[model samples]
Target chain A: MDLRPLKVSEVNNYIKRLLLSDMVLSNISVEGEISNFKHHYSGHMYFNLKDEKGKIKAVMFKGDNEKINFKLDEGMKIVATGYISVYEREGEYQLYVKDIRSSGIGELYRAFEELKNKLEQEGLFSQDKKKQIPFMPRKIGVVTSSTGAAIRDIITIIKRRFPPCNILIYPTLVQGINAPEEICRGLEYLDSRDDIDLIITGRGGGSIEELFAFNDEKLARTISKLKTPIISAVGHETDFTIADFVADLRAPTPSAAAELAVPDVMYLLKELDNKYDELKSIINKKIKAYKLELENLDTKLNLYSPLNQLKDKKIEIDNFLRDLTYVMEKKLNEKKAEILELKGKLELLNPNIAIDKGYGIIIDNRGKLVKSIDSVKLGDEIGIILRDGKVLSRVENIDEGEKIDEFNL
Target chain B: MNLTYEEAILELEKILDELESDDCTLKESIEKFKRGVILYNHCKDLISKAEGEIKILLEDEENTKEETFSMEV
Candidate 1:
């Protein structure tokens, strides 16, 4: 077969046109981890997206890159949708991405989650430590740019709903490089104000890099120390900042933070009117019921007086006294006869009669009355018992020791 | 007349909570019931309004897409 040699630029342009026209290649989704990411001055992003098997070059033009909600970092997993084309000058194929979004946890996000979980486990996010937002805030301090749309939106919504609420603006930078320190200072300023009932700190929607100030650990810790409730409103509804987790309450937007900081004045006024009417009716009913109770008591007062009860008690006492006197007099006569009988029995048992008949007792040293010579041992002390006298004696000899046996023979 | 469904729903919730609580007396309960009926009517009105609003937004989005495609062609 005969063939003609083709130039590199011609072949590349043909491939580029072919790739652009291929619908499958024009709108394709690729999943890989990003590496060697570079952002050019023109705002175009260049990066290599790789899987375990291979890697591909990718480029996101400025317009497409602006739509990314989060920062792109090396080693961050992403899913990119783009058209495939050959770069004519480099003669290399690359993906020209229209959209690139996070497919899994980026490195910074993973670090953020890790630190958040650690702090939460250490009890930093405990509900008991969270201060309650006041139901009716008198003065709300806001920490954001004085000229930014966030403060403007917050003030508008707050004033519209609750006209009486006062606002104190700390006016800190809500974005850019110096935003974190400015936010911290703003929080401190608001916290020092004794009149401030609560603080709402946040910014409007932005890229993750622009919202980085709210994700600072120092700012989050500062929010935790505020005596006034801190309501975090950072980024858009899809964005979450560290301040959101550490704050007492997290609102989806700056305007929402204002709404949460103070109750709707119209709703509150309606509730107050309802309560007032209910209280008035309750008080009126109570007054009428109390008057009726007093009237009923007045009617019973005439029939049931204290003097009537005392008169009935006096008659009962008199009847009880008469019965008591009769029973006492009968008991006294019966007791006198019993006393006389007891006196006669006592006289019959008197010892003077027995003593006059001349009976006597003899006792030894142990107080036994000895009646014979054998009753006590020789050399032992003895006591003689007589009708009216007692005598103590000691034995003179043992001659009588055999006398008892002789007398028996 | 300008009431939205979300507003009516919120009002009904408040009325229901008041009636269900022990704090309200029988007379208060009756008043809340009457207010709740008014809110229910407002909610019906708002639902009809939302249906119209959604249809309008959807048509606008469709027209914008058609216009973009024609310009591209």
Candidate 2:
């Protein structure tokens, strides 16, 4: 190596060239506590980042400084991203910060919280403002990166759970500076259509910085104002963004959002089957009850049947006939006895009986019987009767009751 | 019966209610059972006949057109 005397400016210029040539040094990120933070009148930010054993001077121009989301102060931990270069005049190496963000919490996170609070105060996330998701959505609109895992997962889930739902996808950029506008456009496109019943806007899991677009104020407000119900499914389950709060519903993942949007066909089919079974059983019960009622009515009607009443009446008539026959027999017997007694009495008085009892009877020729001699005229002839024979003889005189003994022989 | 799924379900529930009532005549109950069976079949068919279809809404310079959507995955 040839040794040559060099000026301080020449060495500084050479160091600057060396630093610029190095790609890693030109683009670097340094995380440390901010010590000397100053906002100059020229609208530039000057700061020094110091860690436990090292420190570096950092500067952000007004243009880049305006991009920072949080106010920079001393003793705040931050990650300054920029190129490392050597200043010729000062002959010192420093970080030329292009952007500064809070180290753990992140400037994007702060902005998200700020917007979330503001919108919350505005009542954009009120429950009454939320539109109920249709139980059976005919059409669903999806806004996400066309090629990301979010769309694939959503489509697969929706296809598996509920088939007939029409899915309309608005392919959009999900990150970077232009993502918010594209997302808004997608929302607006879907909102204008009357056929879409629901909208799902999301992307796969990513770093907080990668998900910054979802925290955009314009996008959040756009989601709040959409006529159609929106479900926000962004990043992982733990990642909460402004869009999540403003949306009508927040799904932990893209797959979850699809589940919430539609119902399972198998479950509905099972419910229908259960309903059918219940109806059949109920109808059977009704039939059984009606059969029982009919049997009871048959028995009741038989009790009052006309044929049964007629049979009862026939039995009563038979009983009355038997009683009448017994009374008639008794009366006939009594009459026979009285007739026998009269015959006995007539035996003392009748001619035949009197004849049998050694008494005689007389009759007139006209065949008329004379008890007191009033019926007979004592005219031509008379007859005398005995027990077994009769004889004819002439009647000489008529006998009254006192002279009846004269006829006796 | 050409009842939709929801209509069929509603009619089926009504039939059940009628069958449970004490005043329903046997003739009327039987008629309701027949109708309920028809509605059940209608609802089941409606659910079973659904085919999974995906559609994409494409916007061009002038208008939006809907087309069948299919992916390799």
Predicted complexes: DockQ each: 0.03, 0.45
Model 2: colliding residue pairs: none
Q: lDDT of model 2 at residue A40?
A: 94
lDDT by residue (A1-409, candidate 1, tens digit) is 8788889888999999999999899899999999999999998999999999999999999877765645789998899988899989999999999876578536558867887887788777889988888765667777887666887788778777766666767666676446777789778866886978888889999766567677777787888888888899997888998899989999999988877876665675566446445534544554566679889998788558877778888888988888888788778877888888887888777655665666445577778656667776778887655567867778776554445446532
lDDT of 2 at A387: 72
TM-score of each: 0.42, 0.59
The whole-model C-alpha lDDT of candidate 2 against the native structure comes to 0.84
- Candidate 2 residue lDDT tens string, A303-347: 899998999999999999999999999999999999999988876
- Total clashing pairs for each candidate: 6, 0
DockQ: which candidate is best? 2
